[model samples]
Target chain A: MHDERMISFMFDTNLTKHLAELSKINFTDDEIAVISNEMSEIISLMDTVTEYNIDETFASADPVQFSDLRKDEIKDSFPREEILKNAKGKSDTCFKVPKVV
Target chain B: MNDLLKCTVKELSNKLNKKQISAVELTDAYLKRINEVDGKVNSYITVCNEQARISAEKAQKIIDAGSANALTGIPMSIKDNICTKDIRTTCASKMLEDFNPIYNATVINRLNDNNIVMLGKTNMDEFAMGGSSQTSFFGGVKNPYNTECVTGGSSGGSAASVAANLCAASLGSDTGGSVRQPAAFCGVTGLKPTYGAVSRYGLIAFASSLDQIGPVARSAEDCGIILSAIAGRDENDGTIKNIDKADYCSKIGMSMKGIRIGIPKEFFGDGIDSEVRQAVMNAAKEYEKMGCILEEVTMPSLKYAVASYYLISSAEAASNLSRFDGIKYGYRSENGNTYEEIIKNTRHEGFGAEVKRRIMLGNYALSSGYYDAYYNKAVKIRGKIKAEYDEIFKTCDCILTPTAPSVAYKIGALENDPVKMYSADICTVTVNIAGLPAISTPCGYSSNNMPIGMSIVGNSLREATIIAVADAFEKQFETKEASI
Candidate 1:
């Protein structure tokens, strides 16, 4: 099942660093080195999926049918205090965070 | 009363109903066992001693009123990820270390309606990200069989709690064999209901498409009892389909005659340990002895299972876990001057290494340039896997395979090697991908006495059939107790 064409994706420390940035995570140089090596190995292992030449016609992702879902009934929400209880910075009804600007 | 710890859920229910033991006494017995040995096992992140005793008192009242059911007054641990109304549902991560849900998960509500006593929140891999429980911030859960080894995770604590008699049974979440693998490692029974069988209204999602809440217990019947109580149509979760079988134990003790057990040759390949392979094969022979037919089947897509599973799961996880920003009801960092900085810093500080790695993988897979090569291809492979399982089930009643490639390894052995750790999930991930019901029960033990588990994978919503098959094997299986 191993195919030469499956080995096209390139993974390296640079890619790992970029992905971490996209993921909103900050890793140290040492951590990046370790994670890069691990990610390269994992991605290589995952490359097996590329071997299958599945017809895309059969794979138009099955959308969850609306009929399968239950009727969305209006219900009382959790109390404001309860909702805000676990937030680190919270006012009476809202979670407080740093200024976006 | 201490001997009562050895009883199954049904046996204990009988004792409680017969007035041989009060709910309080049974709860206390399990609580005492937990208090004594949990230091060594580290199975629990939080033990609800005071609340458990209080709930046990309430259960006694229900029993006195003659309104008790099978799980009434039964003490069981809940996985830390499942939301409980007032209990700290930590998810074994610093992110939600003290976050308490103001509402009970649908399953918790169902169990509560049955008057089941909650023991506490059991530990797990941080955000259920890793295969081994060592990634937990609260410290890893040690195997009850051998404390030096890992209890296969991310339901490791739940399985260990059941194996060590910390509780009569426990609830766990399975995403890529989390519940079954840990149960196998700890010598217990675990069931991963079809994706939509159990409601996921309040299960903290790891991979939304693959995640399922299940039971870990002493026997298949015990898991059945728990599943029956917890599973049903829930208006809160849109994914739950109306299942016909309300009682999973309804077909227990049925004859295995004429049952076609499928043995997929791909599952027992060079990757599987010889001992685990032999043990599962021995289990097939046991089924054959019970007059069941054994047929060698094929799942050609099995080789790509692990890869497909990781890609899809991580993609969903990236989306599901993005909600845990600093503004939310979880851990926050004080080091940031701006909103983005706060969110990024909080995540870096809160999540463990494995969780971060998965998030990175997920981001990489879903990123614009790689979406077609990774996530989309994974979804197609998933469809192919489900189709293959459908064809196999057309010819077989159930597919049997080793729950994991091998028995539990020593702690820290596979944690550093991401590929090795992910490869171990090859045998079990397809069931989740197909949304099938499967049970992992202790079949045989390794030469060094570690437990080996064999899984019976049934078609979608065939939970009762698989449970019955597991119960049949469990009745004759001489399972060893963990020497906690």
Candidate 2:
């Protein structure tokens, strides 16, 4: 059990950019380099979790019973105007966004 | 400092009930204190002066009719992340700089029922991400004890306000030591209630599984008073437990004789500062004098708690924050032709560096190829951590340790090293990972005059016992007042 091989992850600017794209956040080349360096430190920190091979199943700390959930009955919600009050671009009763082809 | 401002919530409640002070006068005193001290403290993002005055007037009317509760006329600060109806709740980000919620959070509604006077929304780390509160778009919050030092965050302003007497008490959310660490650094009391003890209906979720609303106040009893007002099951929040609300302050001043308190040896190793360790040990001696028994115990999984915590929290944060695209209620970029471009541009412009970093890390951890190594492993380790804690609680009534590795340092001390900043949270994150109730109260001050805190952790849903232990210590402890 002590002679286990751990998967090595290669972190670089390309990987950082790929992650940023997946996250839907943009970053400059210089910013990506910085983030790449920072993420390496964080990844090394997280490697401790992989160092131990625990033989246990994952259980939630606070498990919610299915029956304990609130009843799925019809209820009053916020009005359209109240919900849309904070929108930057709003039409008559709905939020407006740029045209997506 | 005004004597009225120095009164704790219980003392002020008694004074209000006895007609010795009117609610308006108490509110004005706090508002005046904020006006004089907040410039240097930078604790508040928005001071609701007119709204506070109006609420105070109404509260006074309720008191006149002899229907006031402990918090009825108490002026308190709300962290910026909590939604307040008709008031701007920014989460200290540019994305929600001008966005005002049309509905109050369930906690806000509960507090309103008690006739709570809203002083203002306090500053915090942007989206409750950073530890120093420096990532806030508004500005960083300074320690009231020393303006150059940081108020440990992401609930920095909430603790700083209570320490500086800007308000009687304040509410702060704890994802991973946000409330307790800041309370430790700022020399006040903070309580992180058991998971599902308080509702999270309108809290801006960083990690839904770890976040719980707690109180930052000058005394543990004051925290209990606030907790009683806010804790209970709510239909709006599904995560809350369906249990009767217990009086958290009911056991204060209880005897500590023969209580078995566990001192985990892993928490006091080489990483802890010597002075901080000494202060906590001194606090243990005090408890010993109070007839409590100290037992040395060990928990091996505490070494991996930070890694497990960050992996899970950041992953949840990534998913929760995806809803803030250009289409909804947050900030929208001005220049983007297509919908996809618009969403990307808005996120790029709206989020701070720390928030973006977490998003990137979250995506990396949850990627298809790495999920088993990172996120899944973290969940398994989380289970192990909970198991280790359960073993200790079988014999120990409560656990004792330092709230932070060290006292607060100067701002920008760990700015360039994010790993170092994250590592400092080791002392406080384990309790959150295990979903237990804990309280951080001032134990002693450092040689440099900075305050140190010690935590008393109880079993899940055992808030009253821990609060009782903390209140007992605070009864004889000499707390230093910040001369802001």
Best by DockQ: 2
Query: How well does candidate 1 reproduce the true complex, by DockQ?
Result: 0.57
Candidate 2 Cα deviation (angstroms), residue A7: 5.6
Candidate 2 lDDT over B363-392, as tens digits, reads: 888997788888888888888888888999
For model 1 chain B, the run of ten residues with the poorest summed lDDT = B236-245
Count of backbone clashes for each model?
A: 0, 0
lDDT of model 1 at residue B93?
A: 93
Per-prediction TM-score to the true structure, in the order listed: 0.97, 0.98
Global lDDT scores for all candidate models: 0.89, 0.90
What does the lDDT read for residue B394 in candidate 2?
95
Of the true interface contacts, the fraction found in model 1 is: 0.61
* lDDT (tens digit, per residue) of candidate 1 on B1-484: 3788988999999999999999999988998888889999999999999999999999999999999999999999999999998889989999998898889999999999999999999999999987789999999999989999999999999999999988999999999999999999999999999888888999999998888999999999999999998887887877787765488988998889999999999999999999999999998999999999999999998998899999999998988889988686888988878888888888889899888888988998898877887889989888888888888999999999999999999998998888889989988899998888999999999988899999999998889999999999998999998877
Error of 1 at B297 (Å): 0.5
DockQ of each: 0.57, 0.62
How much does each candidate deviate from the true structure in C-alpha RMSD? 2.0, 1.6
Best by TM-score: 2
